[model samples]
Target: MAKNNEFLWRRLHSLLGIIPVGLFLTQHLIVNHFATKGVDAFNEAAHFMESLPFRYALEIFVIFLPLMFHAFYGIYIAFTAKNNTQRFSTFRNWMFVAQRITGIFLVIFIAWHVYETRWQVAIGADKADFNMMADILGNPWMFGFYVAGVLAATFHLANGIWSFLVSWGITQSAASQRVATYVTLGIFVALSVVGIRALLAFVV
Candidate 1:
């Protein structure tokens, strides 16, 4: 019973990780494309989400749960794997590292993002206001960090799509997995470029 429960929970975690957790990040990026419009845009997007069905409750489901599982399991996998402290032992080893490094990054980046966009603005503690997006983007450090984070996010999502597909038994063949990987990579690149450009434009 205990073994079955752990196995079941892990599977459930993977499934939830695939849903709005994985799906939502891509969607979230697209929505945040409006960030180029500045604070009003970001606020409008956030507000729109709040208006959605059982917004708070849904957030608990979408935002908290899967995120916790993915992050926890991810850390567990990372540390337990031989490559955690050693070199990329093999292809599978590198794959795990790729996912884990991005996962770790996302943990920090997302927290900072929430602080900057959600709490800061909500509390009216932000200094940039809506129109100053250009200045924020123009800053060398901020722009650099933002671009890196965007790319990392894109990579994370792309890799996650592969993880989700294989876990779901959607494609078992190597050829199919390779094709899916390429397709996801292409999509992430396109979205990241568009999102980054939009943000840069908005800031200017």
Candidate 2:
């Protein structure tokens, strides 16, 4: 029973970590979404986040802590998985591959995003300065990279949400499950378009 308890306990953490990350990503996207309205719009929102002391405290607890736990658990899962990719051949099986690919994308993109934005803020520069964003967007390479990141991150969030629900026993019926997965997929594509459109508005 102890082993069973441990399994359930770990699953609890995984569920909490998973859903929280998705919700937070939406919030993050909304903040970045302000970029669509131009730098001042993004700057106004970004300044509020960085300038406020209370918000910093919230970031430490809400963003950093959970992010650490979730990333670690994700790495653990990826490394310990005994199932080979070729072990299955269905569309469902392809999801595992897709998940890993996007997971890697998010990790890399988030690191670069922090280096560009948060790192500047750390050194007393306004990371959200509209001018900085404009400068970055002026680079075709950087712009392309961000476009890809936004797409991959959206897919990772939406698809992962459905997977989390199934793993947590939340969406149970086969018909309901199928519908939920489809809806999550649709949401992913919709968000990707929103994100790309936002980027284009900034660039053009």
Candidate 3:
């Protein structure tokens, strides 16, 4: 029963990544890309998001709750799992370790990002506009942090997608898994380009 429960939680964890969390990341990048069009475009995008029906509720269910479950359960898995990367020393093994490392960084980055942008705006402490984003990203350290954070996030999501495929029994064979690997790699590269471009829109 204990083993079955663990398996169930693991399956849920993988499923949650692709459903709301992964889909949200893609949507977020698209919205943020509006910054490239200028401040007005970016602000309009922000406004549109805020104008959605039951905005707070949507955020709580679609974003925050899923994120909390994914993040905390991920941490639990990281802590409990036996990492034998040292003995294995293979590409896949390294990526397994990297996944956990990136997850930790992502948790930190996402928390800080949400606090700085969402919570601040919610409390009337800051405006959700291009200038506000530019001001934050214009700083050298902050810019670097954003770059690193986005890279980590994209990689984690990309790898998680591949893992999700396997976990769901969608890619069982070696040939299919290899194809999934290449596809996920492509996703990482594409998302990294979009994410970094959006960040640069703030910097430049």
- Candidates' TM-scores? 0.79, 0.86, 0.96
Clashing pairs in 2: none
In terms of lDDT, the best-performing candidate is: 3
lDDT of 2 by residue, 43-156 (tens): 798778677778777777777777766666666666665656676777666777677677767777888888788887778775567677778888999999999899888887
Reference-based lDDT, residue 97, model 1: 80
Better of 1 and 3 by lDDT: 3
Model 2 TM-score on a 0 to 1 scale? 0.86
Global CA lDDT computed for model 1:
0.73
State residue 134's C-alpha deviation in candidate 1, in Å.
Answer: 5.1
Candidate lDDT (C-alpha), each: 0.73, 0.76, 0.92
Q: Which ten residues in a row have the lowest lDDT in candidate 2?
A: 1-10
Clashing pairs in 3: none
Q: What is the Cα root-mean-square deviation between model 1 and the actual structure? A: 3.3
Better of 1 and 3 by TM-score: 3
